[model samples]
Target: MIDSSAFQGKKAIYYTLGCKLNFSETSTFGKMLADMGVVTAEKGERADICLINTCSVTEVADHKCRQAIHKMAREHPGAFIIVTGCYAQLETEKVSKIAGVDLVLGSNEKADLIQYLNDAFIHRAEGTTLHAFHAVKTKDIKRFQPSCSKGNRTRYFLKVQDGCNYFCTYCTIPYARGLSRSPSIASLVAQAEEAAAEGGKEIVLTGVNIGDFGTTTHERFIDLVKALDGVEGIKRFRISSLEPDLIDDELIEYCAGSRAFMPHFHIPLQSGSDMVLKLMHRRYDSALFARKIALIKRLMPDAFIGVDVMVGSRGERPEFFEACYRFLDGLPVTQLHVFPYSERPGTSALTIPYVVDEKEKKLRSKRLLAMSEEKTHAFYEQYIGTERPVLFEKAHRGKAMHGFTDNYIRVELPPSLARDAYDNEIMSIRLGGFNHDGTALKAELT
Candidate 1:
């Protein structure tokens, strides 16, 4: 329980990194602060507290977490700094040693922030002390932490599931997030209704592995989707990301004809080579991944598909790299999220042979990024001279406004449309020629 008067006039600012789940969790903390009468700090305003939600999936992400902590501390010298999320969960002692972090919470303890902060404030007023570090074992992160983003009304990331069961060799997510688990379907629906009430137009279902839903209960991911599609007020629900093996024809067919589900999918295909898949301990092979995309395209040709790829992991010789390149060259994917592999401490991938050098990793990353741009351009070219519903997210960004269609194409509107009336509102836009820089599609009001 919160005494609203405690925070009646204070302000808190938040900085988030990593996945949709992290953003959703941060929003939950923000909502708790709001209930306690703490408002989010306005632009260029000072805040009493600064919260940083972090990620440690890759070496780059870990570096970013550390940088953000130090940056926030330096920028707001007097603010009470709190750091939580994957990096904090994995490197609790390291984060606690950072110069201005007052408190560090593990993944499991993040949801208990309201209680922890309340105690800290009480001790502060009474001239007592509070612990700076509060972290539990990863195994204790068993329960689901329900979170929904309220900062953005166009699309609220609704975390229905948490943790991961598959401990892939090159991955630290399982160690950082704990085991796979989910809340009941009924519970998710209640949360979705609340988000809709908060002016959320779309709900992006996010998790460590959303397709692995219902492991605790008897329900399935399909069951959850069917229920959410029928919810009133929400314009659509988007599957943030999912595994290839978990996506079946049944789920694809349901989404194809659903009234609320969008036509977009982001499946991680780390390496196209089957040998690399085995080395990484991935569940499905390249053939199954291609088949899944084919099925989705057959059902909905206009569907946008994004794939995650790791450019340079262990056990990738020249031939294996060629196999991966060939596989991706043949696929009909719309976009690629290219990542260069970096070994994590205590992961099985460190023992794998043929470690790729950083130089080669950069080269491979550049190649894949070029491929991605070409694929994205081709995907957008098809929609030229077509009209689609564009949900304008930011109506004022320098000189132009930006929005996205149902299939996830970035549409840029002229300065004339840069009005508060179009912000967070869905409207029909006509796709015109490709921009001068070939970055985004030029769109006009239809």
Candidate 2:
């Protein structure tokens, strides 16, 4: 319901923070504005409006949200700034206090942004008044429904689920995101098919917790993948991040055989010590997590496995940290995402004893990062001289094209294979060697 007459040809810039869910929502918002005859512009360019989709996962994220607002305001003083997402939902007062933010919308009120902007513009034209929608309770607002697949990407992130149910002592996601919810299987398949037809080679299923997908009728995650595997045109499918407990043998078996599914898994293991996991309120222990990895290896030995680890957390001493290092070193994971603990307000972890010192935290982080590099190199070395299917995306930085193998290995193509046809096209690439960062593989067309 944007006022087309007041700003018929105005341009808008969108900045998204946090996960793939935020990106998907921002894209939807962009499309909605486009339908209202508003043009889209890249960030830092002159635009009439600036929209920020924010995150509140860590204190650093909060700082980034403020920095983005200040930076954008400095660049374009006349533009109207609108803020939405988890940060706005939980910290509305803090966000509203920022210098150039004109309107602050909660997570649930995001769908009404277009209408709100129209009203604001109409009032401004009449010189009547100015208003702001801040501190709107998320529970009172209706859900902003997701749209169909109208936009396209070479690798599309289809958000089939939202929110979380687990109340981890060290997390605030449950409060910010609410309970778990998922789209229907019929709707998901329709979206996937549209993305496939739109030249999307891979569809990455993303959510707060994708493993907890179906809540409607107890439908399993594998059931959803089975439906997506039948969709035509999409040559590959991947999952974002899943909980260790949710990954069962059945899901592993399905991905092992499915031609469309990619051989990759990213599971978060916040702490490798069972005692520390208990304090963090994680459901599964390290033993169970290791078993899950073993099962995956048994099915697909060459699978690209990624694990998340917290470098420093409550109740983690030197001995506990050693246990974590030993556990991960023995695993066949391709890489590790190491996060140093950053305390958030209202989380039980903030009150725990034996909090790691900043110096020690950095040391632990560096150690784990070195382990990640070694593990990644070893994994890539195993794939030397192997030929895998690579979907080359647009060429960038002077005739170099980049793509990925089915197992999520980053493949770079030489100038010979990097023709214009490589854009949004899938081709076979030979895994010739590894770059300095073993996560990336130097490839030639096979």
Candidate 3:
């Protein structure tokens, strides 16, 4: 049992890096601690405990995690620091030697974090700062960790699935997260019910390679989507970052007809050249990605289709880059998420030949990013003078409040209004003009 003396009146703060899935899991941990009477530390208040949920998707992310840990160590010198997630799973030894980290939990161990922490606290010498690591490599995974993120976010994210089976040559997630696994349909529906009851307005389903949803029990993702639609009180639901090949006709059509599902799709198309696609071990080609975008536009003409593209993966010669550019330019996509490829340790990408120089990679990335800006401006122009329902967030940046529309447009509210009244409320706003170099929409209350 946990020593109530150690936790009863303690304050904890969490900082997360990486994807929405990480945020949801960290939030779940926060709720778990709160139930045990450990309150979150207030703003400008020093915390007794610090939790840093980490990511190691790229080399830069790993560097950022290390930098953040050292900064947290200095900022919260007396706090017991705990580290978890992908980076912890991969680099437990390095993290253990860090100045302030007292506990480290990996992917499998994190699923049982509460019990592990309790046991650790019981065995530890009183007032001693000792470091411990718990990282269990995933093997034949059968259970799904349930998670939800609220309060700090406008949309509640429900982690419907976890892990990845597709070992794309350039990707390290499959090894870090393990083979794909998902919670049963009934369990997720129940979570949706709880979220709806707790005043959650929008629920976005998130996962690592969510398209690879049911590897264990053979349940379909569509089944979960259909079940969630019937959940009462929630106004909207969104599927986050699905794979291009997995965006089937039935699934797209179901989302098109469903009232709750939003008209926005974020699909990963790492490369547009079929040659580079094969080299990267990606399952789908440029043509397949184009077809998926075409299908979404055919059904919902005003749909916002987001694409994720990698800039400088191995074997992306100048010709290949040109081909990729042409393919993306020809597509009816709205926005582009351009990532510069960084080599991860022990991946198939390391063995690939003809690595692009760092300077060349940056050049390619700049071009794609500039193209992204132009495309985004054109996308925003279409919505100008039109009206859309925007779901506003709780916090304000200085004098302005921010939010997003159903079609994934960023919106802002005037400083004159009562900010508290609009927080977490969806209001009809006329899209007026662009701000921040076409990155945000200026809105008028309707």
Which candidate tops lDDT? 1
What TM-score quantifies how close candidate 3 is to the native fold? Answer: 0.97
lDDT of 2 by residue, 1-446 (tens): 55578667889888889977888888888888888888987644798888999998888998999898898788877788899888888888778878888888886678787888898788878986444755445345435356433243457778888778888887777667666778788888998888877667778888888899886447878899999999998888889899998998888999999979888999999888888898898999999999999999899987999999997887899999999999999988999999988888888887778889989999999999999989888887788899988877777556667888888888877666577777777787889887555547888666
Clashes of 1: 0
Q: List the residue pairs that clash in candidate 2.
A: none
Model 2 residue runs over 4 Å out of place are: 42-44, 128-131, 134-144, 147-153, 216-218, 397-399, 415-417, 436-439
lDDT of candidate 3 over 255-329, digit per residue (tens): 999978999999999888999999899998887888889999999888888888998999999999999999888
Task: Report lDDT (Cα) of residue 54, candidate 1.
Answer: 94
lDDT of 2 at 98: 88
Model 1, 1-446: lDDT tens digits are: 75556667888999999988888888888988888888888878888889999999888899999899888888787777889999999999889899888889987888888777777777777987565887778777776788877564467888988889999999989878889999999999998999888777888999999999998877899999999998898997899999999999999999999998999999999999999999999999999999999999999899999999998899987788889998998999999999999889989999997888999999999988999999999999999999999888765455788778999999888786677778778888899978778877998776
Estimate TM-scores for all models.
Answer: 0.97, 0.94, 0.97
lDDT of 3 at 83: 92
Task: Give the Cα lDDT of each candidate.
Answer: 0.88, 0.82, 0.86
